[model samples]
Target chain A: MNEEKKISGIQFASLAFISRIACAFTGIPNLRTNLPTSDRISVFLIGLLLSLLLALPVLLFIEKENNRGLQNREKPCPSGIGRIILIFYAAFFVGAGILAVSRLGVFASGILLQKNNLHLFTAILIIAGAFCAERGLEPTARVSVLLSAAVLGGLLFTGLCDVGKMKLENLSQPFAGNIPIIVREAFFEACMNVELPVLMLLAPQIKIKKKTHLLLWLPLCFVCISAAFAVAAAVAGHYADLQVFPLHSLAVIAKTALFERIDDLLASLWVSCTVLKTGILLYTAYVAARTAVPACKKRCFFILTGALVFGGYLLLTANIQFFANVLQSAAVPVLFLFATVFIPLFTCLKNGRKEHKEVAKQ
Target chain B: MKILAIFLCFLLTFTGCSATVGTQLSNRLIIEAIGIDAQEDGFLVSVLALHTQQSNAANATETQDSIGQVFSAKGKSLSEAFAQIDLVSGLVPLYSQTRVLIFGKEIAENEPMQALDFFIRNYTLRESILLAVADAKASEIIETELEKNTLVSKNVQDILESGKNNGLTVAVELYQFVNRFLDETDAAYLPVIKTQENQSGKKEITHAGIALFAQKNLTAVIDKDAAKGLLWTAGLIDNDLLSIPFKGRTLSVAVKDCKSKIRLHKGDIPTFSAEIQFSCDLIEYNTDDTLLFNLQELEDVNRELQKQVQKITEEFIRTAIRENGCDCLSLLKKLRNGQPAYYAQIKDKQTDYLKDAVITVQISSEILKTGREVVKPN
Candidate 1:
């Protein structure tokens, strides 16, 4: 065991939470791309809550690792249950990567550039992301920390600059929409964001002080999700729902002194975040294959990167409406539920009972 | 060794072509301003494009190019007409830089939506782009260039940023105009601009009256008097001079920060109630006789100001809505959004919807100061 591994349990939870909260900005854009004026706040709140719920379980798993003797279990032949959990995590993270990259491309082009260059830019971004992933997890987490700071800074700058434009009365009206749609979407979205902790299983050999991770994870998740809502309300006001990407438009509206526009800065940050997120997912996928079949680790990195690069090129280049239709129907709900709900339940039952049996013996 | 060589070649191949492919400055002629006018043959389109220049700094200055090239084409459709401009100008037109859209009275009257479709569908165009209706040919206004700001293709852009508050001109952006079209009860009112040549060699633009559009066609034009009153009713009143009759004397009041809320009541006579709140400090008072300061007198002055404001608002609504039959106040939309059941009941009949709507005025005005000082007996 590498006793010197310094990643705290809280850091593990932050990584999962940040990665999933980033998805709220992505998947929610797809569901209500051109939402009407009245529904903006509801959709924004739904996006935030759904993302937080999806991010919580991975947070729980990482917190419980030390007590279960799961630390330093990386080198040995992985148990059948652990292998399945790792595979599901890889799928969830990769799916999130595709969605995030695509959404970034759509929003950057649609609002900031106001041009039609999704194909060229998205391919370039995904390729760069895949290259970063081939390096390793430590470098990727470092990038995540940098990207998180940039995103936070951009949000604060836009909020402070556009102080006069926001109207509290505009948001005074209670969220008006179908409750079923809001509740169901929020639950499914929770699954989408929380699944990032499963990837930590590959590098789970890095142990941390227990229980403290949960405390840090929940607050960071809550703050990030709540900030997104506040920014949407402040920038868009009555027009939030009418916008395709409220955050992107809000940045454009924040025409501050000394800077012509902060929207471009936001796009640059998104590109950086997307790269960090993609790198983490691809690295996890590489780790999963390595754990399942140890003989092919070196070859697998290039294979997974190459395959993802091609997939990204095709996905971004294709007509936007085709993917938009596919995403809305069943593909998103099915995939999101499978990872956030089904997998969490299955893992909890298996891992929970194992810990219970061990506790009984004690 | 063979597999490694094959993989290296493939990697080089993907990376090799990626760098070589560079974006050539698209032949796309970037349109700064567009004018749409109804012609004998469909619509005449005029686009002002800055002449091609290699230097980026040229665009920021007035003399970027020798002259901003003007291209005009006439066809049944806006896209078709614009495509013809490409034939003459020999540049592929771009709409990303488009700032202002000018509509002629004929086009605004006959059909404004026909000319608007091109802007709506195009992803490159922004919904925040300003919309203006011209008194005459929209081409004349676009062609008039400022002596200093020579590359000024967008005339309305200058007016919206600098124009004094005029009752005649109601400046509405593309998004707000479109919302009027989408909402069944709300009629659109667009600001009108007319061009005048100045002897000082500086181009000038004046805001004419507002052009009202109902069912996406111009119903009538509201002249300055009705426009001013309508503005007061809508609570957009700013820095307006109001002569308030106080007891036996008249005081000039500088009104500021006005807001109103309208409520609809159902029954035999559909009464519309409006509560208007405004802040005004006394600017000046002129009278021959000396006045005594008393609480009853102050209350009387407040009541008199209230009655005067209410009368003006009612007259304004009567002219714009009752006479012209255009609901710019969106009494219909308010009913639908606020009271849906009432909206349904009156949805079928226009008379039921328009006839019953009434205006009720409620105002709370605080007099910060009664001018500089009170008149002492001398």
Candidate 2:
């Protein structure tokens, strides 16, 4: 459909990095808002471990598949496993794309736009993402590098300036109240960060490095987000849990010498991150969806992919919390089963079947 | 085609989207201070707004007509009350510039739930608004025109900042107050603003003391002196002054810095203790001791000043802890952080534990500049 473009490991890494931290702007996973110091720390550690577990399979797959993700043109599977991989990747991408839009919709209603409905911003976001998706994956990854800077800048600015307001004693409970909830929250949170699965689908087009992007990316993301979580809890204290949008409230409360109303400024900067996150998910879906139609080109696939995601968002926008619940309860186990378990098992079976056929011919 | 594109660009810029345009400023009223009073059925909300366009108008104006207007409205809910103000004045009331929230004594004494819900839910209002308990009806504070060239809001904000910086009262922003209400300790304090009649019969607002709250309910109103003690034990001191009577000569010095390190003891019973260290610079003195000019006199004065401060602070602490049962210094929080196991043991019985616990006040002071003691025996 389009000429193959090889992207560097860092650009690929940057896309994954932005996708992971962008979810944190609304609320970081695993860390409870305004929780006791010890419990917060424990939740953050558990979330980190689960993400690493899911990410390891993708790293191994990219290395074993000779830097190709799902886009290997040379190897064709018997028993129609290629069709299965393509359809599964497509579904996962579409699911992630809708989740990002819905979360942004729930957060933006009456906060940034100062209106009761988020349709305007959500529609604009979908259009911008579709435009980016039309340009293909490398362009989205390149744009991600810029979006990454803006997102991190806004996050750090609000987090750093609220130092005077921190009340450490508010977060002094050094022990968790409930272990089961902590573990459950951590498991649900790992799936919310959909970048790991997206990376597995795109590894073929990327120039694989000996030390993959996850090495530097994961710790950077965890450190920055964990710092944000801790600062938000320390500054907001007992008021943290009461906030509907915790980070937005933190931004609303924080002020510098020259700038007040940082919430508006940061929310505006987040528009770019939202588009990039949305674009990457939609682009991944396009790569797999194009496999089904022999005559379908990349541009048509991109348009169809955008149309389906936009329709899905329109239908699901009314119940944002429903998608959030589905993500935690169902999405994590299913994504792990496919990305970590099913994909590897099927690929090995197909490879063994091919090797047996060649030896019999000899 | 190019001409059509240029025409479209010209059409697009027609409906401008600037928030601070000159015309819009006239329709928007910037409220700088708000006063809320409880009534039999509804609430009386007073607003001090900056008449932006009128103030900027070129005219011969009197001191009383300097663009600050106080408007009052009554309604069941805060939103309804504010909307009524708009209906009466026809100008949109913008709370973004509001710096102070004055609560009538009656409302503060009863409960602030109705007003607090509106404030916390409103997206336009900032959490940094300084909350103060008015001495009488909040409308009186908003209505009393000050003999200044500024709005009442600016005056109140400056006074509150000065008092907070000088350790005269605690700095309680709306966010901090809400946080304390949500805290497990269930105690917080707000500065009290009182209107005093001067000799000329002019009424002016002044800082009286602090109003203590236990989970949104008013518990006690302590004076400024007790609040200063709370500051001392909490290590939040700014510009403090101490006058000492040392061997018949009064030594008054400006305190440079006062720091407190508090520790909570846990065992048979949990106890709270504070060790305060202060350094001062001599500003003025009326003494006839020649030793006052020497280094020994400086050491003696420092020691006596420490004793006098210790006694004053101890009295304030006793008033807060024993009399009112208010944890003004957040000793409970310190216990939770510093000693968790002990905190767990006494989380349920914190008030009783504090009552039985021993409180010790230790002060050490150093007088840096004992201005040249050139006064010989008069």
For DockQ, the strongest prediction is 2
Off by over 4 Å in 2: A1-5, A27-40, A73-80, A116-118, A299-304, A307-309, A319-341, A344-362, B1-23, B55-64, B246-250, B266-268, B287-292, B338-341, B370-378
- What lDDT tens digits, residue by residue, belong to model 1 across residues B253-334? 7666666666667655556777787767667668766544455655666677777787777776777787776777767766
Q: Score the docking of each candidate (DockQ).
A: 0.11, 0.29
The number of clashing residue pairs in model 2 is: 2
Score candidate 1 by TM-score against the native.
0.76
lDDT of 2 by residue, B1-378 (tens): 436433432332221122223337778878889999998887999999987766777661653566788889999887788999998889866776798999998888887756787887776677778888887888888887777456778877877877635778766788778878767775788888877889899777788888887656778888878877777777767668877776786767888767777777775566777889888887776765444455666667778888877876887777877777778777888877777787788888877776766888888877777666442332
Q: What TM-score against the true fold does each predicted structure earn?
A: 0.76, 0.88
Estimate candidate 1's alpha-carbon lDDT, on a 0 to 1 scale.
0.62
For candidate 1, the chain B TM-score comes to 0.76
Docking class of 1: incorrect
What pairs collide in candidate 1?
A50-A190, A53-A190, A54-A190, A54-A191, A54-A194, A55-A194, A191-A340, B29-B92, B29-B94, B272-B358
Model 1 agreement with the true structure over A64-105: per-residue lDDT tens digits: 553332223444776776666556655655666666666665
